[model samples]
Target: MTVARRLIPCLDVKNGRVVKGVRFVELRDAGDPVACAAAYDRDGADEITFLDIGATHEARDILLDVVARTADQVFVPLTVGGGIRARSDVDAILRAGADKVSINSAAVKTPELVNEVADAYGRQALVVAIDARRVNPLDPAAGWRVYTHGGRVDTGLDAIAWADEMARRGAGEILLTSMDRDGTGEGYDLALVRAVVERVAVPVIASGGVGTLAHLEEGVRPIARGGGGADAALAATIFHDGHFSLSEAKAYLRARGVPVRATEEGR
Candidate 1:
């Protein structure tokens, strides 16, 4: 049986509140992370990604209380990221009720953490997040670079190469976010998604810049069909702004020939 493409809604939490921004700046409040997560779970989200956009920059720990609260209210897989620097941090988040842990800055800083987490929690529980930006906005061929600290720092590493390394190091999945398209609402950088998708054998989650329901479809369709070929599509703005319900988004994809898991209401 073919695997169903997943639709994940991201909650970029800061100071315990969900926020959205353009290219990771000028963030505006959306709602309480726990409340927003519960709403998505009710509406048919396959999984929810809770990213603490400020924890790494501020050098703080993830809010375990928020993770515990959200997990208690949702049944879908909960992937919590940011401020995860060590295996101990991963242990804390998992114990707090998160199903998976995503590591960004810390993973790039100490690549071994990827291996360590995988060994301790099993590869299925580790997700490596890659925040990538094109070296030249006008030139996709220039390739992409990796960014960390909530897309605030350029690591000067080739994004595709980094993704392969992370996967080889034991990342079960990769959360690939296009920093340039982040919050722009244009759409995902399909080239960037395709590049990373082609490079790594693990599942790639296409994130950033999802304006229309069509964009979500484009992110998950197969590359042979002129799509990004991502195993999953993630978005924040379109969902938070009420552009469409998660059910609507899934329905749209199904209508367009993408196989997605049906919601509880069977829409």
Candidate 2:
């Protein structure tokens, strides 16, 4: 059975505001996190991912208040990440109304945390986020290197191997972001996506570098057809900037024969 693909709008929050930039730098204000999420929900986003992009780097907790407020406003599933160092952090984020918690730096630092969260909350509630940059940006075949702390620190772990390890440790989903492609709007690193998807049994959400609706379609295209074969496609700049709406994205994907959950408007 073909699992319906999901469309997720990512909110990279810093100091309680949604922001965007190229390769995770020069971030400009995007909008209020809650408003952006509500808008995505209204437009028929299958899910919303709210990442506290600064928390891990700043050595602070994620804005739980914002998480709670966004939770109150959006009906779709919310996945929150950043500064998730311990099980307590995951517990708090979940209590803040996030359906799942995404962990990156902390997961790399302490792999056991993945086990703890999965054991306590079930694998469904644990998402391991991997931010990867190709070792040779000029060569896609060079493989990818993992980076954490909002893509600032190189973890020296092979992206594909790390993803497999996380899935082995009980992560229900892998949120794979191509740091080199992030905010570039070129497209996803389909090679990286395919490598991870081929290695892991868990769902992989391909993120970063989505510039066009065609990119979204390509993200979920079958690997056999030279596409990412991702379970979900996540974008921020395109959706946040009004380049397109979720309804339009869904319509585009459907027109291309991708089975996506219909939005209320599309329905």
- Give the best candidate by TM-score: 1
Clashes of each: 0, 0
Least accurate stretch of 10 residues (summed lDDT) in model 2? 21-30
What Cα-based lDDT does every candidate model obtain? 0.88, 0.87
lDDT of 1 by residue, 1-267 (tens): 399999998888887767763222122333677877877887899999998866553323437888899888899999999778788889988999999999999998899999998998898999999999999999999999999887899999999999999999999999999999997999999999999999999999999999999999999889999899999999988887776888999889988889999876755
Cα lDDT tens digits, model 2, 104-150, are 88898999999999999999999999999999989878899999876
Give model 1's TM-score versus the native structure.
0.92
Model 1: ten consecutive residues of lowest lDDT: 21-30
lDDT of 1: 0.88
Query: Candidate 2's C-alpha lDDT?
Result: 0.87
